[model samples]
Target: MEQPKRLSRLKTTALPTSLSDHAAAFDRLHPQVQRWVRAQGWSQLREVQTRAITAIGGHRRDVLIAATTAAGKTEAAFLPLLGAAAARQDRGVAILYVAPLKALINDQHKRLEGLCADLEIGLTRWHGDAPQGPKTRLLKSPEGVVLITPESIEAMFVRRPASVEALFGRLDAIVIDELHAFLQGPRGLHLWSLLHRIDAISHSRARRIGLSATLGDKQHAAEWLAGEGPQPEIIAVDGGGAPLKLQVRAVVEPPETSPPTADLEARSALAEIARHAHEILRGKNNLFFAGSRANVEALADRLRTLSEDGGVPNEFFPHHGSLAKELREEVEARLKEDRLPTTAVATTTLELGIDIGSVHSVAQLGAPRSLASLRQRLGRSGRREGSAAIFRGYIREPYLAADADPLDRLHLPVAQSVAALHLLAERFVEPPSGDPALLSVTVHQLLSRIAERGAQRADQLYRAIGRDGPFAAIEPGDFADLLRGLGGGEEPMLEQAPDGSLMLGPLGERLTASRDFYANFKTDEEWRLVNQGRALGTLPIVNALAVGSILSFAGRRWRAVAIDDPAKVVEVVAHRAGRIPKFDRVSGEPIHDRLAGAIRDALVASDMPAYLDPVAAQLLAEGRDMFAALDLARTPLIAAGKDTHLMTWRGSVANGLFAVLLGSVGFECETFDVGVTLLGTPSDEAAHVLGALDGCPPIETLGRFVSNLAHEKYDDYIPEDLLRRFWVKRHAHLETDVADMIRRIALALS
Candidate 1:
């Protein structure tokens, strides 16, 4: 086998020569902070810290610090802000730290405790699990820093609206950790609205500071952080030239003969992955990303059993959203202490920066959801000096039999993995792509704003939540329509008074009164899993299980002895044999067009990636051979028996639009990763249809073919036409992306 090509090393930026410059930055810090730095035995400040001090302390500008993980970004943002806060005599909260997750807030609370204590700044943790004494004290005398999550902020707006002004009216800075996580989702939009709302409430101009390790579009992120404010000073630093060491391993399972055989094949493949992971990573501290909750539980259980069989202490644990807080925290604590070698099989929960002590490497069980995710996961390793960042990827591909589906024979997963590795080497990261008109979150913020101010005019609500807010995609007409629907629907959520102010209606009062209304995202109903009256975890109610059913959870097997339907609790006991339970979550993300193109390129190229093991190389060769044999390079449409496959080579969104277009035109179709399948349609007929296509069909015509339109939390409450508009705006880029795809397919078919 040929040796893999190594990624080019990044050039390190030259540091300033003048010692006086460094001293100037150090002198800008508060005296106590300077002493604290000296006590830690630090020689000089890092480049990011110095730059941040100059930008934040000297100019008092909003800043976005983009650097590698564990590169002192927290200190860079806090030191200057803390110094400024100490210089002020105002009593309100000085800094408002907003994070995406409660765990991250908890981690920062522990990490910043010493610094705040030394500076005599009051630090408070405000979240669901945080103690009430500190919260009450802070409410009485709001001061110093308050670390909180988005949900907590929403809760305050709804439940303690009158007190919000007192708590954050004089805030000096708003520090957002993991800024990229909030860039392009419903949660991001919700946070954006909250930030604007905070600004509206505060008397002081709070400088916004965003911190992230993975930002593909810095300009877009900067604009997001600034909102209507001035553009933030971007402080980006490349990783200190750490070489990446990567390898891709392939696991092949027997062709599926039936449902039972397919299940056995999956188990066999998982076992193989576990054997390899145990042999290689057992004695080292590392993170194994299993991509989903079910996979996390299965892999962790297998690793635990492997340890027991080897007569060694268990070092593997599971961490995900569904696990009980105590169980998850125990795993986190074990990893941080590093008293013993620990390997955590987790989902995206552990991908964020939680100050888990440095690990040896990262293992991914499949192709990562996106290149950005892969980059973030890899950042968890190679923190120690002179150590290369290590990544191990395991891709399970089905054995190609003569009767295999064309999609299976292409080995798309293996191809996708290789493409991601190549893109990483090329320093390519996907930009944030989310719905522009996130009407669901708009509804959430609309109600939140009304509840916050007691009552609001229609124009005031539109301006606050739409025109000058994150939901800028909404037009004035659509805003009016939304307001009308909310104020006059069968189940009105808003009522208009004689003064023309919109207030909470009966249904709205009921919703806003509940604690569950704080969240912008939708959550499935779940049943708690209890063992001997102790909470183990939660399983989605969608997972059907009877009393005799045995399942794996929290890295252990359990038998459901009884399920209390009224209480929504499952009583379980230890069991030796069990199967993994399915959760109501999609395991994959929308593949970017660039990634899809890269996969197509990988299949067509002759040169193989050096990082692939022998088995992986063989799989690539097989895919390439199949690609050539089917003449997929020359045409986008191919006939495989009675069906025709149109290889659009576009992202999932575009392909979904293409499928809908076909279905609207009276052709039965389905979508895969790269293409749409026209069932029972011959190649010639498919080509004729494709060549005759002009542009995207009407939204109403396409809507007839789409399902699951009510995906967002508040989508059901929205008017039907507006809901369809939201779906079309988010899922289908009809006028531009889909139209362009149609033209491309037409030309190819012609």
Candidate 2:
């Protein structure tokens, strides 16, 4: 193989020799790097590095470095690569670093820049935020290492073809950071396509290494990260990071004496949160990860009240995507400066690998959503010596009604999943599964191909996409339909050329050119509920539009003061909502099949423990007494408390189905959030809805129906109306499964 001439011809003595050789390389680290490590107390290299060095020394074809957060995976991936880069002698984006988040790339650049000084490894992060100078330099001379977000990488192939070819031609290895986040979205598909384009352009297959710990599913995750061609070896280190302390406590707000208003509950909860936060705030800086922007602002506002009353400086900060960059950055800076024992109430903006000061604890208002989330939140703490991630999850309730479902008793199951991830210190992690709806990625990649090789015959485009692209298995009929739609028409997002040279159609242009399209994060496009342009806080599209309608949000209420109808904005002056509307966060509930089954098994095996604090314990006892008196857990239908009905056997989704179907069965019924309610009188014939729902709604079932009434943003783009049916029908099986589970309980108890 002829190598590039800009050569060092240097020996990778560090890699070829044993760990001691690499250790020796580290010994001569730039004085600054050594001092920094020593200042943090000279500890031995982590296991991730120990194993990585051995693999890199052997010139291991590919490596996957899996370890817990704060376990030094970055050092593991880069330290060994320094040798290979030094040996290859030619520099041109010697390594292509890909991370799921641009912020992560920035964080990695800051942490790795000092170490690079010793080896003169030029490192830079390229993304929407990255300026043109370094990118231009990479184009002119692809020397050194470059870091980029998956989105930026996609843009590189499409917009900067020549630059990518030149820079990546001598690429030695591509490092994928935070590997899990990309394995299941349009972003992942785009990332894979980008890698394929690199191989096609450069011709020489580059070695690959992946860095992640909190990955939920590594087996599938590794394959996704590996791309389709040129398989890579996997290297995972049991991080052996510090232990985490996690606890979930339920917070029950007193039921409103009057109408349910959001502001009232928010204010009420805020007071309690302030008291608890005050005690915890006495320690290191903390982060409270809320599920939404409204929650962040409300939590921050309430916490500020505590400071005001305590005669202390304001320590509570707010962060989310909608906040102006300056405001968000200032909150981050204040925490970094240790200006006070501060805490920032934030949404997923703080979820990425952004580097803020180490904290003593993390608090979440509800479920952490995914195992990976639990791992990331816990990682925020324990960054310093003897520090541990202390998390307190609060689930506010309308006072556990007399007859809540047994499953309701199992709310902490999500917490259990989080605990399992934290057990990663013992070297265990779950890899997430690849999602099937990565069609958005396919569109992005296809457009990149069209841009590279200006128009293609319809058939050639099909072969390229189906035979070679990630959509290899897409049915021919569907593939043809898609092509016909794309050939030349008025595209809302894509601006088509007359001869079909597939320029970015209006919709395509908006989607591809904007930084937002690259984000696979399914955050709803929200607007700040501003009062005179000062954001009262942000609200979802649906909530913001429902102006003048009485609604509770952020535990506070205000008549939607005014609606910026054009901008889709709402401004609510804070008022009391005694009970807050539970935000319907759309992330899939991680239903561990095994754990759910285990819960059923546990239910039959022994008495389930009262997983409640002493106060809730008494309430739970009353709850159990109420259930026993009503026998609601075993019965399919029970008219229990005044307005409440119990249906313990049916899960939430199933109950929803049952309620909807019963309405069709001539029952004066409507679905309540938890159970079915009869508007007036209910007949026993309504029970027939259960069996009727078992079959499909009959393909041609009529009721002025329409196709593609989808909610998720990507749901529209893929144009998979039929497949959407499949997903609904498939998920409908959950109702069936719950029904069966209910039957078992009913029969066993009877």
Candidate 3:
């Protein structure tokens, strides 16, 4: 075979001698695959691909390929797997390709079909939105690959156990896409249980190959991917691309001389945003990541209006979870088309790699939720060679008058975001903190297990759920208590059989009967926004309009003329400039201590960051000035007009705990971005507060401080003692972290 031109230009970690080795590895692939590669204008395999083929084809152990987006990770995993499947020629499903998003599965299904078809290998898709024809055909044949989601797998196990066994009985491997997404939370726990259950049932050792772009700590991620199974080998592939070009610019709003009008503030903010988007994003294929769904809608609407006013083509679209699937797909499709220069204002929905083609730049409308999230969004840009990945971050800190909110005075958001950008530049991404004790998932899996195989024995249930399960940390006694609470209560979830077997109770049956039971996470009751009987999209019922309320959605403004509560529908008419509604944020993903520390350090550092634009630079300077004037960095606990501020300078979880502790002890307190605030206190007693905090109060003693502790899913079902334990397990490190904070406070006070 002739050496391809692109092969000579390939940049790989492997040395010159290793080029022959890589070639030998490529030649080992099936002849059809070789021809396919040559037909596609031949290029040498990526270093990650070469390593992946070796590990997967050799059948050494489970594999993890950590590479950048659009780096041909899919091809890397599939090439060797397909080769192995062809060589082996087993009847049952050759591979189980699991993706976090159905959209991803659909995209991969299209890409993989031709490759599979050429080799006479069958490929099928199984998801809620997928057509039934392919699934039924797969049921009959049970061969090749089946692309699916974890929820679909749960549903399959519950609804069609026999079919699942028949289809996946001889599964060769489980390839997990966007592997970092499933490393924590209920979804991660659900995936863990599902994989374990599949292994147990199939009695076959299927290799697990995990893939992701932004896995911070490779070791931790590998341990997470290897959960109770044989450890997976890490294939670390450098994200070879252009250097990242980043800038942090503050959208400075005019100062309120004396009580600014709300309407004027909103309008000016929108106008400024429009100007910024038009200035930087017009004509270029880019993405604007809004902090929230409401922000996405608002910004997209403003950009569209700017385009109309300027007589430019409307290239702006809103892409978020609240938007209709068709609308989101339309935006995605337009982005992929070469001629269309479109920009999508989106939430975290578009952060993941979903084959949306190359974006010229990525702009953050506000500070991202976390550094991990920021890194992921930044990865969306700068894919092409000889070009830097452009990231323009816009943080808006409203100008405050005298007597403005103290929080606003802090300018914490801008400081945090600027600090986050610095952290990203230093290549400091938060590693996944694995939380294995997701009782909600345990509850879900319990229901699913019993529903799938009716009347399981208590011991058998314990063995499945406790002994070797993902929730192994759950004590047997606690499991028993959980069972009693779930089964024997007024709203019983499980029924005990005469032979001491467990089955779904009335409530459990009702829950399992619903389609929503397929997922482990809890979804808020939502109302669908409709205009002229056309379904717009759904928002949480909590965010519903109250008769006269107005909100922006799908890049259009709508006024709620009527609301049908029972039907969960909001009837709206086209309107201009309604207040953007508020919705509850998904909780429990805490900021790592590193991020908080970095932000604090940034504030104290003398060097000004070059990435900060004029406004951002001003804000940073103002914050630093405040820090020095108030002597905050030196004295963490200070008093300002009968209000004592305890500058904990800690992450959310720590700050939250401290605030709760103070409030529980009957001190009027509120949480600040960088610290805790106590009201009606004098400067002289600030030392006393610090002294008291030095000896970290026991969590049990601070139980009264914990009010409205209803955060986790299925907490309602858990008993009081166990729930308390759950909260402490997640939030309380009183003896270690809190005590350390107290000592720091003591030192500062001294």
- Give the alpha carbon lDDT tens digit for every residue of 35-78 in model 2: 65566575666556666766766664667777767777887777
TM-score of each: 0.88, 0.76, 0.88
Candidate 3: residue 63 lDDT (0-100): 89
Give stretches of model 1 more than 4 Å off: 1-20, 255-267, 434-437, 524-588, 698-701, 730-734
Clashes of each: 1, 36, 0
Q: Quote the RMSD, in angstroms, for model 2.
A: 8.5
Q: Residue 388 of candidate 1: its Cα lDDT?
A: 81
Which stretches of candidate 2 lie above 4 Å from their native place?
1-43, 239-241, 258-267, 334-339, 400-437, 468-470, 488-522, 525-612, 620-633, 636-686, 691-750
lDDT of 3 at 215: 79
Instruction: Output the worst ten-in-a-row residue range by lDDT, candidate 3.
Output: 579-588
Task: Please list the C-alpha lDDT of all candidates, in the order they appear.
Answer: 0.80, 0.58, 0.75
All models, RMSD in angstroms? 9.0, 8.5, 8.3
Per-residue lDDT over 390-470 for candidate 1, one digit per residue giving the tens place of the 0 to 100 score: 999998776556655665677878898988888888877788775633888998888888887888888888878888745
Task: Indicate whether candidate 1 or candidate 3 has the larger lDDT.
Answer: 1
